[model samples]
Target: MAFWIFLPITLSAVSLIGCWTVYGLALRFNHICSLRNWEYSNSCLTNKTVTGGCCTEYNIPTISGSGTQFPENSLFSATINAASFLFVIFSIFHYAHILKKCTVHRFFSKSAMVFGCLAGVGAFVAGNCNPGELMFLHYLGSALSFVCICFYTVLLTFLTSTCILTGLERFLYPVRIVFSIVQVTLTILYCIFFTQKDFYYRHISAIFEWTLSMNLELFELSYAVEFYFFSSSMLSVLLSNRDEENTMILS
Candidate 1:
Protein backbone atom coordinates (compact mmCIF):
# COMPACT_ATOMS: atom_id res chain seq x y z
CA MET A 1 0.00 0.00 0.00
CA ALA A 2 2.74 2.36 0.92
CA PHE A 3 4.67 1.41 -2.21
CA TRP A 4 1.71 2.32 -4.37
CA ILE A 5 1.35 5.66 -2.69
CA PHE A 6 5.03 6.48 -2.87
CA LEU A 7 5.70 5.46 -6.46
CA PRO A 8 4.03 8.44 -8.15
CA ILE A 9 5.61 10.89 -5.75
CA THR A 10 9.03 9.43 -6.35
CA LEU A 11 8.63 9.52 -10.12
CA SER A 12 7.42 13.10 -10.01
CA ALA A 13 10.37 14.17 -7.92
CA VAL A 14 12.84 12.44 -10.19
CA SER A 15 11.30 14.04 -13.27
CA LEU A 16 11.29 17.54 -11.79
CA ILE A 17 14.89 17.19 -10.63
CA GLY A 18 15.90 15.91 -14.02
CA CYS A 19 14.34 18.99 -15.60
CA TRP A 20 16.21 21.30 -13.27
CA THR A 21 19.47 19.53 -14.01
CA VAL A 22 18.90 20.06 -17.70
CA TYR A 23 18.24 23.74 -17.14
CA GLY A 24 21.54 24.10 -15.28
CA LEU A 25 23.46 22.33 -18.02
CA ALA A 26 21.93 24.68 -20.58
CA LEU A 27 23.11 27.72 -18.63
CA ARG A 28 26.64 26.35 -18.54
CA PHE A 29 26.62 25.59 -22.25
CA ASN A 30 25.42 29.10 -23.06
CA HIS A 31 28.17 30.64 -20.96
CA ILE A 32 30.81 28.60 -22.77
CA CYS A 33 29.41 29.45 -26.20
CA SER A 34 29.19 33.17 -25.43
CA LEU A 35 32.85 33.31 -24.44
CA ARG A 36 33.98 32.30 -27.94
CA ASN A 37 33.37 35.59 -29.80
CA TRP A 38 33.33 37.91 -26.80
CA GLU A 39 35.69 40.88 -26.58
CA TYR A 40 37.53 42.27 -23.55
CA SER A 41 38.80 45.81 -24.10
CA ASN A 42 38.07 49.48 -23.38
CA SER A 43 36.39 49.75 -26.80
CA CYS A 44 33.33 47.89 -25.59
CA LEU A 45 30.07 49.70 -26.32
CA THR A 46 28.53 50.70 -23.04
CA ASN A 47 25.48 52.68 -24.18
CA LYS A 48 26.03 53.33 -27.90
CA THR A 49 28.23 56.42 -27.69
CA VAL A 50 27.77 58.72 -30.71
CA THR A 51 31.30 60.22 -30.26
CA GLY A 52 33.81 59.59 -33.01
CA GLY A 53 35.75 57.25 -30.79
CA CYS A 54 38.95 55.41 -31.65
CA CYS A 55 37.53 51.92 -31.60
CA THR A 56 38.51 48.74 -33.39
CA GLU A 57 35.70 46.87 -35.15
CA TYR A 58 36.94 43.50 -33.93
CA ASN A 59 37.97 44.78 -30.54
CA ILE A 60 38.10 42.21 -27.79
CA PRO A 61 36.08 43.57 -24.89
CA THR A 62 36.87 42.58 -21.34
CA ILE A 63 34.84 39.63 -20.02
CA SER A 64 33.27 41.80 -17.34
CA GLY A 65 32.45 44.75 -19.63
CA SER A 66 31.09 42.86 -22.64
CA GLY A 67 27.49 43.77 -23.42
CA THR A 68 24.89 41.01 -23.30
CA GLN A 69 27.45 38.24 -22.94
CA PHE A 70 24.95 35.68 -21.89
CA PRO A 71 23.88 33.23 -24.59
CA GLU A 72 20.32 32.51 -23.46
CA ASN A 73 19.42 30.42 -26.49
CA SER A 74 22.44 28.17 -26.23
CA LEU A 75 21.88 27.72 -22.53
CA PHE A 76 18.27 26.78 -23.03
CA SER A 77 19.27 24.21 -25.64
CA ALA A 78 21.97 22.72 -23.46
CA THR A 79 19.57 22.27 -20.59
CA ILE A 80 16.97 20.60 -22.76
CA ASN A 81 19.55 18.26 -24.26
CA ALA A 82 21.01 17.22 -20.94
CA ALA A 83 17.62 16.88 -19.30
CA SER A 84 16.23 14.83 -22.16
CA PHE A 85 19.10 12.36 -21.93
CA LEU A 86 18.55 11.86 -18.23
CA PHE A 87 14.81 11.54 -18.78
CA VAL A 88 15.36 8.76 -21.32
CA ILE A 89 17.36 6.71 -18.85
CA PHE A 90 14.87 7.30 -16.08
CA SER A 91 11.90 6.35 -18.25
CA ILE A 92 13.58 3.13 -19.32
CA PHE A 93 14.27 2.12 -15.76
CA HIS A 94 10.78 2.99 -14.67
CA TYR A 95 9.30 1.00 -17.51
CA ALA A 96 11.36 -2.04 -16.58
CA HIS A 97 10.28 -1.86 -12.97
CA ILE A 98 6.64 -1.54 -13.93
CA LEU A 99 6.90 -4.46 -16.32
CA LYS A 100 8.40 -6.67 -13.64
CA LYS A 101 5.38 -6.09 -11.43
CA CYS A 102 3.01 -7.36 -14.15
CA THR A 103 0.76 -4.32 -13.93
CA VAL A 104 -2.75 -4.45 -15.36
CA HIS A 105 -1.93 -1.72 -17.85
CA ARG A 106 1.40 -3.07 -19.00
CA PHE A 107 0.62 -2.25 -22.60
CA PHE A 108 0.05 1.41 -21.86
CA SER A 109 3.10 1.54 -19.61
CA LYS A 110 5.36 0.01 -22.25
CA SER A 111 4.04 2.29 -24.97
CA ALA A 112 4.61 5.34 -22.81
CA MET A 113 8.21 4.31 -22.22
CA VAL A 114 8.88 3.86 -25.91
CA PHE A 115 7.37 7.22 -26.81
CA GLY A 116 9.14 8.89 -23.92
CA CYS A 117 12.44 7.64 -25.30
CA LEU A 118 11.70 9.17 -28.68
CA ALA A 119 10.67 12.49 -27.14
CA GLY A 120 13.83 12.63 -25.07
CA VAL A 121 16.10 11.95 -28.03
CA GLY A 122 14.30 14.52 -30.14
CA ALA A 123 14.60 17.16 -27.47
CA PHE A 124 18.31 16.51 -27.08
CA VAL A 125 18.98 16.86 -30.78
CA ALA A 126 16.85 19.94 -31.09
CA GLY A 127 18.72 21.54 -28.23
CA ASN A 128 21.98 21.45 -30.22
CA CYS A 129 20.89 24.27 -32.54
CA ASN A 130 21.71 27.96 -32.22
CA PRO A 131 19.05 30.62 -31.82
CA GLY A 132 18.28 31.28 -35.47
CA GLU A 133 18.39 27.56 -36.30
CA LEU A 134 16.65 26.37 -33.16
CA MET A 135 13.21 27.01 -34.55
CA PHE A 136 13.35 24.17 -37.05
CA LEU A 137 14.76 21.72 -34.57
CA HIS A 138 12.49 22.80 -31.79
CA TYR A 139 9.43 22.51 -33.97
CA LEU A 140 10.35 19.05 -35.15
CA GLY A 141 11.28 17.84 -31.70
CA SER A 142 8.19 19.33 -30.14
CA ALA A 143 6.00 17.70 -32.74
CA LEU A 144 7.48 14.32 -31.95
CA SER A 145 7.06 14.79 -28.23
CA PHE A 146 3.48 15.95 -28.66
CA VAL A 147 2.70 12.93 -30.76
CA CYS A 148 4.03 10.69 -28.01
CA ILE A 149 1.94 12.59 -25.52
CA CYS A 150 -1.15 11.96 -27.60
CA PHE A 151 -0.39 8.28 -27.74
CA TYR A 152 0.11 8.07 -24.01
CA THR A 153 -3.08 9.99 -23.44
CA VAL A 154 -5.04 7.67 -25.68
CA LEU A 155 -3.51 4.61 -24.09
CA LEU A 156 -4.40 5.77 -20.63
CA THR A 157 -7.92 6.56 -21.71
CA PHE A 158 -8.29 3.09 -23.08
CA LEU A 159 -6.87 1.52 -19.96
CA THR A 160 -9.15 3.57 -17.75
CA SER A 161 -12.17 2.79 -19.89
CA THR A 162 -11.39 -0.91 -19.78
CA CYS A 163 -10.95 -0.92 -16.05
CA ILE A 164 -14.24 0.87 -15.55
CA LEU A 165 -16.13 -1.29 -18.01
CA THR A 166 -14.86 -4.43 -16.34
CA GLY A 167 -16.74 -3.34 -13.19
CA LEU A 168 -13.48 -2.26 -11.55
CA GLU A 169 -14.87 1.22 -10.95
CA ARG A 170 -17.61 3.50 -12.26
CA PHE A 171 -16.81 7.10 -11.59
CA LEU A 172 -13.52 7.48 -13.45
CA TYR A 173 -14.63 6.20 -16.88
CA PRO A 174 -16.36 9.26 -18.40
CA VAL A 175 -13.84 11.60 -16.89
CA ARG A 176 -10.90 9.71 -18.37
CA ILE A 177 -12.45 9.55 -21.81
CA VAL A 178 -13.28 13.25 -21.84
CA PHE A 179 -9.77 14.22 -20.73
CA SER A 180 -8.26 11.90 -23.28
CA ILE A 181 -10.28 13.40 -26.10
CA VAL A 182 -9.35 16.91 -25.12
CA GLN A 183 -5.68 16.05 -24.93
CA VAL A 184 -5.70 14.34 -28.29
CA THR A 185 -7.42 17.27 -29.97
CA LEU A 186 -5.13 19.82 -28.44
CA THR A 187 -2.03 17.84 -29.35
CA ILE A 188 -3.15 17.54 -32.93
CA LEU A 189 -3.83 21.26 -33.14
CA TYR A 190 -0.44 22.08 -31.67
CA CYS A 191 1.32 19.85 -34.15
CA ILE A 192 -0.57 21.25 -37.12
CA PHE A 193 -0.44 24.94 -36.27
CA PHE A 194 2.52 25.58 -34.04
CA THR A 195 5.14 23.70 -36.03
CA GLN A 196 4.96 26.00 -39.01
CA LYS A 197 7.69 28.40 -40.08
CA ASP A 198 5.40 31.36 -39.70
CA PHE A 199 4.60 30.36 -36.15
CA TYR A 200 8.32 30.04 -35.43
CA TYR A 201 8.93 33.59 -36.67
CA ARG A 202 6.04 34.82 -34.57
CA HIS A 203 7.67 33.33 -31.51
CA ILE A 204 11.02 34.78 -32.50
CA SER A 205 9.44 38.17 -32.70
CA ALA A 206 8.10 37.72 -29.18
CA ILE A 207 11.52 36.68 -27.98
CA PHE A 208 13.04 39.77 -29.54
CA GLU A 209 10.40 41.83 -27.81
CA TRP A 210 11.39 40.14 -24.55
CA THR A 211 7.88 38.87 -24.08
CA LEU A 212 8.91 35.21 -24.28
CA SER A 213 12.03 33.36 -23.31
CA MET A 214 14.11 31.27 -25.65
CA ASN A 215 12.81 28.09 -24.09
CA LEU A 216 9.37 27.00 -25.26
CA GLU A 217 7.36 26.76 -22.09
CA LEU A 218 4.61 25.08 -24.08
CA PHE A 219 6.75 21.99 -24.52
CA GLU A 220 7.36 21.80 -20.82
CA LEU A 221 3.68 22.31 -20.10
CA SER A 222 2.71 19.52 -22.49
CA TYR A 223 5.15 17.14 -20.82
CA ALA A 224 3.91 18.07 -17.39
CA VAL A 225 0.28 17.55 -18.32
CA GLU A 226 0.89 14.19 -19.92
CA PHE A 227 3.01 13.07 -17.01
CA TYR A 228 0.32 14.03 -14.56
CA PHE A 229 -2.43 12.29 -16.48
CA PHE A 230 -0.52 9.06 -16.92
CA SER A 231 0.77 9.08 -13.37
CA SER A 232 -2.72 9.69 -12.06
CA SER A 233 -4.14 6.85 -14.11
CA MET A 234 -1.52 4.47 -12.79
CA LEU A 235 -2.15 5.53 -9.22
CA SER A 236 -5.90 5.19 -9.71
CA VAL A 237 -5.52 1.62 -10.85
CA LEU A 238 -3.33 0.71 -7.91
CA LEU A 239 -5.64 2.36 -5.43
CA SER A 240 -8.74 0.77 -6.91
CA ASN A 241 -7.22 -2.66 -6.63
CA ARG A 242 -6.21 -2.04 -3.05
CA ASP A 243 -9.73 -0.99 -2.16
CA GLU A 244 -11.13 -4.11 -3.82
CA GLU A 245 -8.84 -6.31 -1.78
CA ASN A 246 -9.84 -4.54 1.41
CA THR A 247 -13.51 -4.92 0.63
CA MET A 248 -13.08 -8.63 -0.07
CA ILE A 249 -11.25 -9.16 3.19
CA LEU A 250 -13.87 -7.23 5.12
CA SER A 251 -16.68 -9.29 3.66
Candidate 2:
Protein backbone atom coordinates (compact mmCIF):
# COMPACT_ATOMS: atom_id res chain seq x y z
CA MET A 1 0.00 0.00 0.00
CA ALA A 2 2.73 2.41 0.99
CA PHE A 3 4.81 1.64 -2.10
CA TRP A 4 1.84 1.94 -4.39
CA ILE A 5 0.94 5.34 -3.02
CA PHE A 6 4.50 6.53 -3.38
CA LEU A 7 4.45 6.24 -7.18
CA PRO A 8 1.87 8.95 -7.83
CA ILE A 9 3.22 11.18 -5.12
CA THR A 10 6.67 10.97 -6.61
CA LEU A 11 5.34 11.58 -10.09
CA SER A 12 3.39 14.63 -9.03
CA ALA A 13 6.11 16.08 -6.86
CA VAL A 14 8.89 15.54 -9.36
CA SER A 15 6.88 17.03 -12.21
CA LEU A 16 5.77 20.11 -10.29
CA ILE A 17 9.19 20.66 -8.84
CA GLY A 18 10.85 20.45 -12.24
CA CYS A 19 8.32 22.78 -13.80
CA TRP A 20 8.72 25.34 -11.06
CA THR A 21 12.44 25.03 -11.19
CA VAL A 22 12.37 26.05 -14.82
CA TYR A 23 9.89 28.77 -14.01
CA GLY A 24 12.03 30.03 -11.18
CA LEU A 25 15.06 30.12 -13.41
CA ALA A 26 13.16 32.20 -15.92
CA LEU A 27 11.88 34.57 -13.27
CA ARG A 28 15.22 34.85 -11.56
CA PHE A 29 16.81 35.90 -14.82
CA ASN A 30 13.85 38.10 -15.78
CA HIS A 31 13.10 36.22 -19.00
CA ILE A 32 9.33 36.12 -18.73
CA CYS A 33 7.54 36.14 -22.10
CA SER A 34 4.02 35.47 -23.29
CA LEU A 35 3.39 31.98 -24.69
CA ARG A 36 0.98 33.21 -27.36
CA ASN A 37 2.66 36.38 -28.55
CA TRP A 38 3.46 36.56 -32.24
CA GLU A 39 7.00 37.61 -31.41
CA TYR A 40 9.14 35.91 -28.76
CA SER A 41 9.98 38.72 -26.35
CA ASN A 42 11.65 38.34 -22.98
CA SER A 43 12.39 40.39 -19.87
CA CYS A 44 15.92 40.83 -21.04
CA LEU A 45 14.48 43.73 -22.98
CA THR A 46 12.21 44.89 -20.17
CA ASN A 47 15.11 45.12 -17.75
CA LYS A 48 17.31 46.85 -20.25
CA THR A 49 16.13 50.49 -20.38
CA VAL A 50 12.93 51.78 -18.83
CA THR A 51 13.07 55.53 -19.29
CA GLY A 52 9.32 56.07 -18.95
CA GLY A 53 8.69 52.56 -17.56
CA CYS A 54 6.81 51.36 -20.66
CA CYS A 55 8.55 48.24 -21.93
CA THR A 56 6.44 47.06 -24.87
CA GLU A 57 8.06 43.61 -24.66
CA TYR A 58 6.99 42.89 -21.08
CA ASN A 59 4.56 40.02 -21.48
CA ILE A 60 3.16 37.76 -18.78
CA PRO A 61 2.12 34.16 -19.53
CA THR A 62 5.64 32.86 -19.88
CA ILE A 63 6.38 30.91 -23.02
CA SER A 64 8.14 27.60 -22.51
CA GLY A 65 11.00 28.57 -24.78
CA SER A 66 12.03 31.55 -22.67
CA GLY A 67 13.17 29.11 -20.03
CA THR A 68 15.55 27.56 -22.53
CA GLN A 69 16.79 30.73 -24.16
CA PHE A 70 20.05 31.91 -22.62
CA PRO A 71 21.89 32.24 -19.29
CA GLU A 72 19.88 29.45 -17.64
CA ASN A 73 19.49 27.25 -20.72
CA SER A 74 21.78 24.46 -19.58
CA LEU A 75 20.30 24.41 -16.10
CA PHE A 76 16.80 24.17 -17.53
CA SER A 77 17.79 21.27 -19.75
CA ALA A 78 19.58 19.37 -16.99
CA THR A 79 16.76 19.88 -14.48
CA ILE A 80 14.05 18.83 -16.93
CA ASN A 81 15.99 15.72 -18.03
CA ALA A 82 16.66 14.59 -14.47
CA ALA A 83 13.01 15.00 -13.61
CA SER A 84 12.00 13.22 -16.81
CA PHE A 85 14.18 10.21 -15.98
CA LEU A 86 12.73 9.95 -12.48
CA PHE A 87 9.16 10.28 -13.73
CA VAL A 88 9.80 7.61 -16.34
CA ILE A 89 10.80 5.15 -13.65
CA PHE A 90 7.78 6.02 -11.57
CA SER A 91 5.46 5.68 -14.59
CA ILE A 92 6.73 2.17 -15.24
CA PHE A 93 6.20 1.21 -11.61
CA HIS A 94 2.74 2.72 -11.69
CA TYR A 95 1.64 0.78 -14.76
CA ALA A 96 3.19 -2.46 -13.52
CA HIS A 97 1.38 -2.15 -10.21
CA ILE A 98 -1.89 -1.42 -11.97
CA LEU A 99 -1.36 -4.51 -14.08
CA LYS A 100 -0.95 -6.54 -10.92
CA LYS A 101 -4.21 -5.25 -9.50
CA CYS A 102 -6.34 -5.44 -12.64
CA THR A 103 -5.22 -8.11 -15.02
CA VAL A 104 -8.17 -7.13 -17.21
CA HIS A 105 -6.24 -5.08 -19.73
CA ARG A 106 -2.97 -6.92 -19.44
CA PHE A 107 -1.66 -6.25 -22.91
CA PHE A 108 -2.80 -2.64 -23.12
CA SER A 109 -1.58 -1.84 -19.63
CA LYS A 110 1.82 -3.33 -20.28
CA SER A 111 2.07 -1.62 -23.62
CA ALA A 112 1.31 1.76 -22.07
CA MET A 113 4.09 1.27 -19.57
CA VAL A 114 6.52 0.25 -22.30
CA PHE A 115 5.71 3.27 -24.40
CA GLY A 116 5.81 5.51 -21.35
CA CYS A 117 9.33 4.39 -20.66
CA LEU A 118 10.30 4.94 -24.25
CA ALA A 119 8.81 8.41 -24.15
CA GLY A 120 10.76 9.16 -21.04
CA VAL A 121 13.99 8.04 -22.61
CA GLY A 122 13.23 10.08 -25.68
CA ALA A 123 12.57 13.12 -23.51
CA PHE A 124 15.93 12.67 -21.84
CA VAL A 125 17.66 12.35 -25.18
CA ALA A 126 15.99 15.46 -26.53
CA GLY A 127 16.54 17.60 -23.47
CA ASN A 128 20.19 16.70 -23.12
CA CYS A 129 20.97 17.03 -26.82
CA ASN A 130 20.30 20.80 -26.91
CA PRO A 131 18.77 21.83 -30.23
CA GLY A 132 21.45 24.47 -30.71
CA GLU A 133 24.11 21.76 -30.70
CA LEU A 134 22.84 18.30 -31.66
CA MET A 135 19.72 19.29 -33.53
CA PHE A 136 19.36 15.94 -35.27
CA LEU A 137 19.36 13.74 -32.18
CA HIS A 138 17.23 16.28 -30.34
CA TYR A 139 14.55 16.43 -33.04
CA LEU A 140 14.58 12.67 -33.40
CA GLY A 141 14.07 12.31 -29.68
CA SER A 142 11.29 14.89 -29.71
CA ALA A 143 9.46 12.99 -32.43
CA LEU A 144 9.84 9.66 -30.67
CA SER A 145 8.73 11.05 -27.34
CA PHE A 146 5.70 12.88 -28.71
CA VAL A 147 4.41 9.95 -30.74
CA CYS A 148 4.92 7.46 -27.91
CA ILE A 149 3.36 9.75 -25.33
CA CYS A 150 0.28 10.11 -27.52
CA PHE A 151 -0.12 6.35 -27.65
CA TYR A 152 0.56 6.03 -23.94
CA THR A 153 -2.23 8.42 -23.06
CA VAL A 154 -4.66 6.63 -25.36
CA LEU A 155 -3.86 3.29 -23.74
CA LEU A 156 -4.06 4.74 -20.28
CA THR A 157 -7.45 6.20 -21.05
CA PHE A 158 -8.68 2.77 -22.11
CA LEU A 159 -7.41 1.26 -18.88
CA THR A 160 -9.31 3.83 -16.89
CA SER A 161 -12.49 3.16 -18.84
CA THR A 162 -12.24 -0.59 -18.22
CA CYS A 163 -13.26 0.04 -14.60
CA ILE A 164 -12.07 -3.47 -13.72
CA LEU A 165 -10.95 -2.59 -10.25
CA THR A 166 -13.31 -1.43 -7.53
CA GLY A 167 -13.83 2.24 -6.55
CA LEU A 168 -12.19 3.77 -9.64
CA GLU A 169 -14.92 3.94 -12.23
CA ARG A 170 -15.90 7.40 -11.17
CA PHE A 171 -12.34 8.62 -10.97
CA LEU A 172 -10.74 7.26 -14.12
CA TYR A 173 -13.28 6.66 -16.85
CA PRO A 174 -14.97 9.83 -18.07
CA VAL A 175 -12.36 12.36 -16.97
CA ARG A 176 -9.47 10.57 -18.65
CA ILE A 177 -11.48 10.16 -21.81
CA VAL A 178 -11.74 13.91 -22.20
CA PHE A 179 -8.13 14.54 -21.31
CA SER A 180 -6.94 11.89 -23.70
CA ILE A 181 -8.91 13.41 -26.52
CA VAL A 182 -7.55 16.88 -25.79
CA GLN A 183 -4.00 15.58 -25.59
CA VAL A 184 -4.18 13.86 -28.93
CA THR A 185 -5.83 16.88 -30.49
CA LEU A 186 -3.13 19.20 -29.24
CA THR A 187 -0.53 16.77 -30.49
CA ILE A 188 -1.92 16.89 -33.98
CA LEU A 189 -2.03 20.67 -33.91
CA TYR A 190 1.54 20.77 -32.66
CA CYS A 191 2.66 18.55 -35.48
CA ILE A 192 1.01 20.82 -38.01
CA PHE A 193 2.27 24.08 -36.56
CA PHE A 194 5.75 23.10 -35.45
CA THR A 195 7.33 22.91 -38.90
CA GLN A 196 5.96 26.17 -40.23
CA LYS A 197 8.69 28.60 -41.24
CA ASP A 198 6.43 31.54 -40.43
CA PHE A 199 7.29 33.11 -37.11
CA TYR A 200 3.62 33.34 -36.09
CA TYR A 201 3.05 29.62 -36.62
CA ARG A 202 6.25 28.90 -34.72
CA HIS A 203 4.99 30.76 -31.68
CA ILE A 204 1.62 29.03 -31.90
CA SER A 205 3.40 25.71 -32.09
CA ALA A 206 5.38 26.57 -28.99
CA ILE A 207 2.19 27.43 -27.17
CA PHE A 208 0.62 24.10 -28.08
CA GLU A 209 3.74 22.25 -27.05
CA TRP A 210 3.78 23.97 -23.69
CA THR A 211 0.11 23.26 -23.16
CA LEU A 212 0.61 19.61 -24.06
CA SER A 213 3.56 19.21 -21.73
CA MET A 214 1.86 20.88 -18.79
CA ASN A 215 -1.34 18.96 -19.37
CA LEU A 216 0.53 15.66 -19.23
CA GLU A 217 2.24 16.68 -15.99
CA LEU A 218 -1.05 17.66 -14.43
CA PHE A 219 -2.50 14.35 -15.56
CA GLU A 220 0.18 12.57 -13.57
CA LEU A 221 -0.68 14.71 -10.57
CA SER A 222 -4.35 13.81 -10.83
CA TYR A 223 -3.44 10.19 -10.15
CA ALA A 224 -2.69 11.16 -6.58
CA VAL A 225 -6.29 10.55 -5.64
CA GLU A 226 -6.41 7.32 -7.59
CA PHE A 227 -3.23 6.06 -5.98
CA TYR A 228 -4.39 6.96 -2.49
CA PHE A 229 -7.36 4.60 -2.63
CA PHE A 230 -6.18 2.00 -5.11
CA SER A 231 -3.62 0.41 -2.81
CA SER A 232 -6.25 -0.49 -0.21
CA SER A 233 -8.71 -1.48 -2.91
CA MET A 234 -6.27 -3.94 -4.41
CA LEU A 235 -5.48 -5.40 -1.01
CA SER A 236 -9.13 -5.81 -0.22
CA VAL A 237 -9.83 -7.64 -3.44
CA LEU A 238 -6.88 -10.00 -2.93
CA LEU A 239 -7.73 -10.83 0.67
CA SER A 240 -11.45 -11.20 0.00
CA ASN A 241 -10.89 -13.87 -2.63
CA ARG A 242 -8.47 -15.74 -0.41
CA ASP A 243 -10.86 -15.68 2.56
CA GLU A 244 -13.71 -16.89 0.35
CA GLU A 245 -11.60 -19.82 -0.80
CA ASN A 246 -10.64 -20.70 2.79
CA THR A 247 -14.24 -20.62 3.98
CA MET A 248 -15.38 -22.86 1.12
CA ILE A 249 -12.70 -25.43 1.95
CA LEU A 250 -13.71 -25.45 5.63
CA SER A 251 -17.36 -26.00 4.60
Each candidate's lDDT (Cα)? 0.45, 0.67
Model 1, 1-251: lDDT tens per residue?
A: 22333333443444445444433443343321121232223444454321233222222121111211244443445456656666565456445445433456766776867877886776565556433345566557655765665665566456545432224325555655665666566555544543344523323322221211112222232233233323323445445555877999999
TM-score per prediction, in order, is: 0.44, 0.74
lDDT of 2: 0.67
- On the 0 to 100 scale, the lDDT of residue 144 in model 2 is 88
Provide the RMSD of all predictions against the true structure, rounded to 1 decimal: 12.5, 7.8
Clashing pairs in 2: none
lDDT of 2 at 57: 35
Question: Against the correct fold, how does model 2 do in TM-score?
Answer: 0.74
Estimate, for each residue in 12-90, the C-alpha lDDT of model 2 and write its tens digit. 6765666667766665555554443354433435353222222233323233344455766666676667767776766
Top candidate by TM-score: 2
Shift of residue 194 alpha carbon in model 1, Å:
2.8
